[model samples]
Target: MRPVRVRTVAAAVAGLALLSGCGSAGGLESTGEAPSAVGPARLWPDLPPASAAPYDYGEGETARIPGITVPGDDVHRLDPVTVAQAGLKARTKRDSGLDELPDATVRQIRDCRTAPGDCPVLTPYYFDLTGDGRDELVIGVRLPERQLAVRAYRADEGVLTRIMSTVDAVISVELAGRDLVLRAPSVISGYEYRTAWSWDDRQQAMLATRDEILRVPERRGERTAPTPTAPAPEGSRPAPSETPTA
Candidate 1:
C-alpha cells in the first residue's frame, strides 16, 4: 500500500508566510531605494508562459489494484451507493442512514479516491466517541496548505451532518476488531502536520488531535469485548462438591 501522505502543519505555516509576504508587498510597491533604468519599451522578452499543469486538476486515469479492476473511467467519481459497495468490498458495512445523503455529497465522498479528489471510506467497526449506541463514520479529505481534512459523519433525518473538521495526515484507517483506528505520524511545530479523529453521539461529538512529528504510537478504543478466562489449571480438583446439610 502507498504510504499515506501527510501534509505537515509546518508546510501550511510556510504557505501562510509566503502569502503574508506577498500581501505586505502591496502590489509590488517599490521601496525608497533608487530604481534601475530601463531602455525604450521594446517587445517583452519571449519568456515561456507559466505551465498550466498545476491547474489541471482534471479527472485522470482510473486506479487499479492487481486482479481487481473497478469499472468506469472514474470509479473515484462514484456516488454513496458505490462507496458503500466499496466499503462492503473492504468487508465494512455502512451505517443504515448513509444512503440518505445528497447525491452530490455522496459523489464527493467517493471521488476522494484519486488525486484532486477525496476518499471517504466506511469501516466495518464504529467509533462511539460519545458513548452512544450509534457509531460515526470517519471521513478523510485533502485541505489547503498541504493539510488533511478529517471529519465525522452522523446520520440525522436521512442526512449526514458534518460533526467536525480538522487538520491531520491520515496514515491508515481501519476497523480494528470493533473500533475505528486512524494512524498518522507525529508533526513538529513550524514544520509539522496536523491529524485528528472524531466521532458524534446523540447529543455531541468528540475529537482526538495531534500535531506534526512522526514515529509516535498510540491507540484508541470504543467498544470492548469480555476477556476470555483461562482454563482451570490442568485437572486441578474442584473443591469437593458442597454436601447438603442434614
Candidate 2:
C-alpha cells in the first residue's frame, strides 16, 4: 500500500513538470502597430434633406403587355419578336413623357416581321433571374446612339409582365448569377460605370442595387471626349458575338 501511494505521487509530479515545461514555450509575438481605425464621417448634417426622391432610371417599374399574352405560364414558349412588337406599340400609345423610339428603330422592328435576318433584336436569353423555379426571358433591342433597351419579362398564369426595363450605352451586358450587370463607358477617361439590377420580390420588379465607377486601366490610353455624350458605335459597343442579333 505504501509503495502504491509513492507511485501515484510520482506520476502526479511528472504530469505537473510536463505542464510547467509546456507553459515556458513561446506565446503570441507582436508583429507591428496596426493602422488607426477610421470610420465614415458624415458631412453637412445641418443641411435640409432633399425634397424630391433621387432620379430612378426606370428601376422598380413593371407593366403588363396589353395585347400580348403568354399561352402558358412558360416564358420560354413565347416568341420574343412578338413580345418586342407588342411592347413597342404599347409604348407608342402610352402618354408617359419618356423619349419616343426613333423612326429608324421602329422601322427595324417592323421590318423584322418580314426580314428576321436583319432584325435588330438580339438573341433572347433565358435565366431564372427572380430565383423562381421557372426562367424569365431577357431580350435586348438595339436603339440609335448605341443604346440598348434591356428588358426582362416573367409570365404567370398566361399574363406576361415586363419586370424590368432600362436603356444604356452598354459596353457589355452580363448575367452574373441571377443579377443583371451592365457595363458602360464613363465620361471619365480612365473609368467605366458598372450597374447591377437585382430582383426585388416586394416591389415585384428589378431594382438597381449597385452602381459604381471602376478604374479601367486598359482603356487609359483611349481618349473619349470629356463632354457629356452618348455611347460610341461598334468600337465601344457590345460585340456581335456577345450580343448577336436574332
Number of the predicted model whose TM-score against the real structure is largest:
2
**Native-referenced Cα lDDT, model 2:** 0.82
lDDT per residue as tens, model 1, 1-246: 233334566677776776666646544345578978988884666876766555421111111112223333222323433434343223112232322334554465566556223444432223554445555555554434444444444443343443443444555654443334555544442232333333323324434433235534334563356999888885795766698667
lDDT of 2 at 99: 30
Q: Please, what is the TM-score per model?
A: 0.29, 0.70
Q: Poorest 10 consecutive residues of model 1 by lDDT?
A: 57-66
lDDT of 2 at 183: 98
lDDT of each: 0.42, 0.82
Question: Model 2, residue 82: displacement in angstroms?
Answer: 0.3
lDDT of 1 at 27: 43
Candidate 2 lDDT over 190-222, as tens digits, reads: 789999999999988888899999998765666
Q: Which candidate comes out best when scored by lDDT?
A: 2
Off by over 4 Å in 2: 1-37, 54-56, 91-100, 217-246
Off by over 4 Å in 1: 1-129, 142-147, 174-182, 187-203, 209-246
